[model samples]
Target: MISEAYSPQTRNTKTVKLQADLVVVGGGLSGVCAAITAARSGLKVVLIQDRPVLGGNASSEVRLWSLGATSHMGNNNRWSREGGLINEILLDNLKRNKEGNPLLFDTVLLEKVYEENNITLLLNTAVYEVEKGKDDLVKNVTAFCSQNSTTYIASAPLFCDASGDGIVAFMAGASFRMGAETKEEFDEGFAPNIEDYGNLLGHSLYFYTKDVGKPISYTPPSFAIKNAEELPRIKNFQLGDHGCKLWWVEHGGRLDTVHQSEDIKFELWKVVYGIWDYVKNSGKFPEAANLTLEWVGTIPGKRESRRFEGDFMLTQKDIVEQRDYYDAVSFGGWAMDLHPADGIYSEHNSCTQWHGKGVYSIPYRCYYSKNIENLFLAGRIISASHVAFGSSRVMLTCAHGAQAVGQAAVLCKEEGLLPKDIASKEHIAKLQLALNRNGQSIPRIALNDTDDLVAKANVEASSSLKFKGFSEADDWHPLKFGLAQMLPLKANETYSFEIEVDASEATSLELQLKSCSTPNHFTPDVVIDKKEVDLQKGKQKITFTTTKTQEQDHYSFFCLMKNEKVKVRLSDERITGLMTVENKINKAVSNYGRQDPPADINVDSFEFWTPERRPKGKNIALQMAKALPIFEPDNIKNGEVRPNANGNTNAWVAEIEDKKPTLHLKWDDKVNIKSIKLFFDCDYDHALETTLMGHPEDVIPFVVDNYTVKDASGKLLKEVKGNYQAINTIELDEAISTDALVFEFSKKERHIPVSLFKISAYN
Candidate 1:
């Protein structure tokens, strides 16, 4: 027997108190991105997740794949690869876990959060209580950790309810909507006519099955539905198919998807087991004798719940019209996909309709609470009508929304303003600058910073002014049918492209110009001009006149048809927003889809091509005038980074051996410059990759390893050492008055080949 004198106290709960600049509730893709964005901006952030793992629905527990602007390869959004952290995660997944393993993806999310030292992640911590401080602002939130029986009271100036269910907003007395709003509310053409509100999109359960090479026995439980026709969902089930392969296997939306989550999950369980019983023991599938249930998700992935209202309610009309907001911070392209009220049990298809012309913008007004002064919302909980949520609900889109929220929150904290004040003229520009500086894309918004030194000074480079080569040269191949590659050309100008052809016989090639009204669409809107030429073999140049008459430069979809054996140069490398793949007659899946059935793509071959982001700068004339991916020698300098979209190598790379490439900014007279910012290419194309045997990086270490800035007197003003970040913002110790500023950068000891996207200076 032991005495109790020396025993320590054992309490039912342990309390932890924390204070941070920002507190993000919910650890989904949106939450992770939001936390990371704010934290990376040098703010103290605390990210709290209810589940043990990060990535919310993408976590192992839920097992849903992240889908967004790419639209699961089901649509024509070929150029809509999301930029920033979302793009990083996707490319990383492609390189590392092309298999799309839920557990492996979970680790990537976990590692990203863990690597950010400014973020305080509290896993297995569910926030259930929130209190208001002075001026009815959110002050503190209380989260309980069931794993350790610990309670955490997190305090912050701002809170983000990325909970997907709007938990934080609900607890903070924020105004929110539960279901579909009437068309009269927002003039949404797709809105349900009757408006029997509260009938929401449902929850889904996913499972994976595998063949073990041996017969597996399964005893059907009493609750299993014997007949496949009972639910009508068994027909879609196939052996070895898993995850969202069975997306329609859903329920619980007609009811309260949040409060009745458990009930919905229980119903889903019965459906899953019943279907498996039909596949194995129901005598319908003898081939499944060796198949067994590998894994089934216990937690249900909720599609719609409580949506906190903001300054703006994004409507289907807004998406269809592509309404541009002055405070635009992010974009969404997934169609306005909506389901029937009955969900999977409905007689009609699971998805009733998809709206919107193409990719659309999401504004800053819809990201923050209208009534709750200190609360910001992201993910599915953002302010959108039922119709618009269908588009913005996708994971990557939500992550971008979170990125905006995080950035805006940081700006708010820094400026000491409330959530609603970010829309002012001065602060809105600051917010956009922050997003653009971090590589977040705001569609059609170009950074024309006035303080750029290169814009005012004469620029020169050591290399050829023309782009060296075409990105699609290696992708060239023979095509029996006609192939088209869109060329971006200025109106009333002539452009030429060189082709390398090896043919058994002479071929008659017909070239035609297809007009494009929508700049981003992959196919030609109409055919306007045509030309024909006879080709011999080896190498040849073809010229065409850009007569579309559009004032601003627009894409010209040019089609080529060979009457004989001829190979045309083609490179359809995947770059963001440049080359898009689409032929009117031939249609194919652009890439892998998360919803696709289980199959090893490596062993099975598929040809993918799209000159979607083809760089117009490859034309010798344009390269001489416009500055490109880096600070290359060009006539025009708008201080934009990686502005060209259609090339595999978007950044300007210096000569292989000439590591010390110096750029001179010369003006007519001495000017006072206060600061300069440099944009380097961290290899945006290679920014992400997930591999089993090797670890990849978020940024390619191919930037200016060493650099020096000098005044007209040749005196060093600022010097940077061991540089790796994508954007470098420098504040001069004192304003220097000089006619010329020199930037001299060198590669590392091993000939690193420095790359710069853009550089700007401000007074």
Candidate 2:
């Protein structure tokens, strides 16, 4: 409780009046991202949040993972195209704490906000009042900080209401709607035929667990449901564990999600603790005896709340028809997961599908405020009909929506225009270009005809390409690999085949087949041998050469790196004599290139391999001959090794000896190095570090190059910098590279004691 009186002399009491180019209220996923995007584009941004932390319901307080539509369902770890501020948060979290938990979410979110120098974050502050001019545009916002008992007056050229509740819009005199609209209004099939103007779906607190063997004796609230069968048209009990999750049935029945949060919190605590007590007391399973409660969310994840009026309202018909919007900005693939409008057990549990496909497009028009010139709305607050909102309310879709809004805010700040100005073709094109650069996928209809490629391979294009390809290859059974097929190849001829797959599902593709000459020694191969491609959505073409064959052996083709490292071997009988590759027993070649041999070529031990076998007087040709280089810092004169005395000086040390020399370093400091110039007395072409020798502190000498560091056995230790500065110092944070520090000077610059110095390191 803070006093209402203000001491003008005190800094806390002194009302700080500030202005910005853009003001984003609510530092949730959407607001944070919007502020970041706008700020990155040179906009002076002020992000105000009612809570202390960012990330809204996905923050540590709520303890929900920031999942996108492409998240989960086997695509959890893949790089999302909706990678901007959200990606930065996730990447920072992963870097700081690789534990894959939500505890680090707030820190990462703050880092992202702080990383953008143009963004100002105002936390633990609530927008209490709004000032508007005669034109009905928001002039300034008054935010009251309960913690400091101070009110802040802020003015901005543009405003965004990403508060999830649309509080800013409501205060700014913007038109909005709550609860379900009349059936005639939206013409939604699942909408009640009668008008029951009331509260929308109940907010819930979600939790997760991994213990398998457990049947807790938890009795749900009389209001809470036991199964999905209680709802109309929901008969499937096999919808996976999510069907039985704690929050799957519990809800706080309230109209005002913002004000009723306390009630929701009370109900959530009841459900969470009740379930925990039941699980603890009930002797269901011995495995769950140690089942621990990982997290308990405080904020209720409100699915449907305030829907702001925008330039255009996205309707259910558009979703069903898969209508392509010229101003499309985001997409959603999750089904219309509408919760019941009333009691814990209500008729409406889910929404009807448009087509067999569960994906839909959302346009840019749905993201901005109705009357506010430069204001935008993201997340659940977007202007979509209640029916359409049911499908677009998922977190992943919201993330995409947030990303688009962020980009739109940047455009608004840059072009000095309103959100409606972005509706034009050129502006949308610019937005799409930014999105593509950031890896977000924009669905497009195929203009050119590539149907002939599938037809030539005796395949037909179906309504949806994903299931069609799998259906056609159903008869083609899997071998050692799960499912695969082999087709005979023509020598020196290029053949093309297209595979249509769900971009959201497929992670990668490998057009693997046995090498022609290695009849007995099967070398698992890829058509495009140099690069690895992610074949998620769209079509892919595989082309390879069958120049010669040593003997008559079958080659294999299949998809590897599936759910696990296992391979899916295609059918070989369809095109007999064609090889089918197996994923097992096949090792992928390391793409890291070899380093040039040091100037003083010395070898304590040597190992070499050559293509010795010949077929029909045709000798196998060697592609290239090379040896791994080693750095002997001890032999090089004027190469004085020393410890880096920056920050944690104890972490690293450099030394040399009569027989062996090494760089001793702790694996805690991250160092960047450039070129390694060693001075020696004699002219030599190469140098070698012995595998047996271990120097000071038992540290092995490792050669650090541009791209990678390799040990004596030529095993990769760490990813190296491709290009670096001349004076950079190579810091060893991980395993030692080589036991003996050997280096070859390009020219004889020094004699006596070989020295290596002027080692510089930078970011």
Candidate 3:
């Protein structure tokens, strides 16, 4: 523990007073994000966590691998990821904790807080009291430091309740609900038939094993469920399986996940210890001879508890239907996985059913307490039905909300308004803009800030866009029976659509283009065009075009369908509107469940493309032609990070063959500039696995390896050497007055192709 870093006194008689623009309660992913985001936006923040270390469930104590909307791309939600603060954690984790060592992971989170000058982190501080003033606003919070024994009273203009259990909100009398919302209550098809069952997803504990190399004797725990049969509900138990799999061990849903958190933890411990005993001591486990217990968690990861009420309570319907909200500030793509409250004791399955299409939007109204004027909420406690919560509760998804609320807190402080006030139509856009400017991914909101030169100025490149990526075995879809590919198309426009087919014989192929799933709400609806073509066995391209009448929706998603014999190309490419959807031919296998070429998961979701782009340098132009996201020089000023970090689609590409390339920026008004920040194409989606088993994401090749900044007169202003990180910045000794500035590269990293995600200059 890092307790020695602070005072060692166990008890203190005095009260400590502190003040800040924002005070975040809880140090989990949500709180970490909320605190860091607000602090980065120029607000003083006090982040308090009850634990001696950080990263709640994902901490060494619990050891749960962080999961979110993308579900690790290869797993599901192919095109999804929690971009802002959560992504930063992933990237930093890639850089520092590639081995996935829990202790090192803790250090990364702690160091991040320490690096943020605007944040004051107070560890082992448990908040137990909240002060409320007129209009139900929070005045301050009182927390007791366990080690130092000092009571800290932190007063701030705004407060964020990321305390997994909504402790701060509960103490402040924030309205909340426990248990499942009735199916009719929110029209959640996934809700239990019963009205309001308090049964919730349970708590779970994890254990790690090490190979002793030599056989070792085993000792059985007295409380071990010796005959694994005692827990028949848990099937396919294996010593080799780990990480969020059912075999990791879970329990306690029948009991209150919050009020009985301790009791539930104890029960989970019994289950974990017993399982190990059964694996080692019972005659059933011969493979356990060489494996020994390396570590077991003392703390259990709690899944559900008190969910605070917000302006809009997210319902299962919202997730299944992919509801669009003008105030949307975040999104979640994890399936609505609801386990029976009975947990291990019950005979029911862990999850009810995986829900509809890829990632869905999360509105801003769900981030703040409905009645608590100053209380904003993040993490598992945010307003969402048990079913929807099943999906949003994932750590990375929670981190997304944390970023939204953090940005909103900045707005609340700057505008001198309440959370509700910021929710107003007038101010909501400002909040979104702030989030966008900071690189948070708010689904469906194209980064179109006027300050972005790409969105306003004329853009040109040295070459036309070239598409990269080979058509591998996993790069195409067999469009037959029930599969379709979503293609974003313009209204009343006809464009050539190509298909790559590998048919064994010249089979008659019937193809159709249909609208997106909604309103009609099913695949292959409102056919825009239909054609029947004969195909050959080898790779062949068939181009078909269709024009929609103006009567059709101004812009609608169209899907391409083929007969059973046809196969369509599924590029690893990232295109603005290329999504995939399919109907399950059988209940056991969902189109969304296919990972062969994850981009073609049958579920109606965007193709999950990790680091969603081609390897750098190879597709410098073709991917650009496919195009908008091809890291055009305009993207530098687009005010958004590439949707997928490691991918090239959302990045601009350049080849360093002859003279090093240069990017020149000119302003008609000639404004004074003080600092410049450049975001190189670091391949955010470049497959970064948090384990030593895999390799690190390439250190983005296009980073300004060595570059010089010059004025319009060609005079050198600044020069940087051997740059390798994603973000490189230089604050001038003093503000320089000029309408134009130039960044000329002397040398560029060539390990991979060069790419840039974004660049920003500020006064």
Which candidate's TM-score is highest? Answer: 3
Q: Name the 10 consecutive residues with the lowest summed lDDT in model 3.
A: 616-625
Rank the candidate models, highest lDDT first.
1, 3, 2
TM-score of 3: 0.80
Q: Give one digit per residue, the lDDT tens place, for model 1 in 414-506.
A: 889888999787788888877876667676566665545667788655542233223444444554545555445455544444444545576
For candidate 2, the per-residue lDDT at 179 reads 72
- Please give each candidate's TM-score: 0.77, 0.55, 0.80
User: Model 2 over residues 1-763: C-alpha lDDT tens digits?
Assistant: 8676766774656587879988888887888877887787788988999998888876766654444433222111111223334544543454455444455657777888988899878899999898886455888888988888878898987788888888878887788988776667766554533334244766767555444465433444554323333343333212222211333434644446667767766765565555545444545334455445545666666666789999888776666455678888776644344555443434544322221122356888898886887678888889888777766775556766777887887887777877888988878878865663343444441122121111111111111101111112222222223223333222333323333332335555443333223221122322322224565443333332233332332232322222332222121111101112222221111101111222231101111110101111111011111211112221112122211101000011111111222332222333233223211111000010011111121110122223333333455444434221112224455434233222221211111112232221212
Each prediction's number of clashing residue pairs: 21, 57, 30
Off by over 4 Å in 1: 1-12, 73-79, 88-99, 193-198, 229-235, 282-287, 352-358, 450-458, 464-482, 494-511, 518-523, 531-551, 560-580, 584-756, 760-763
Cα lDDT tens digits for candidate 3, 470-562: 232345556543344433333465544555666766776765665533331222335566677777776776655554432333223233443
Candidate order (TM-score): 3, 1, 2
- Per-residue lDDT, model 1, residue 296, is 85
1 or 3, which is superior by TM-score? Answer: 3
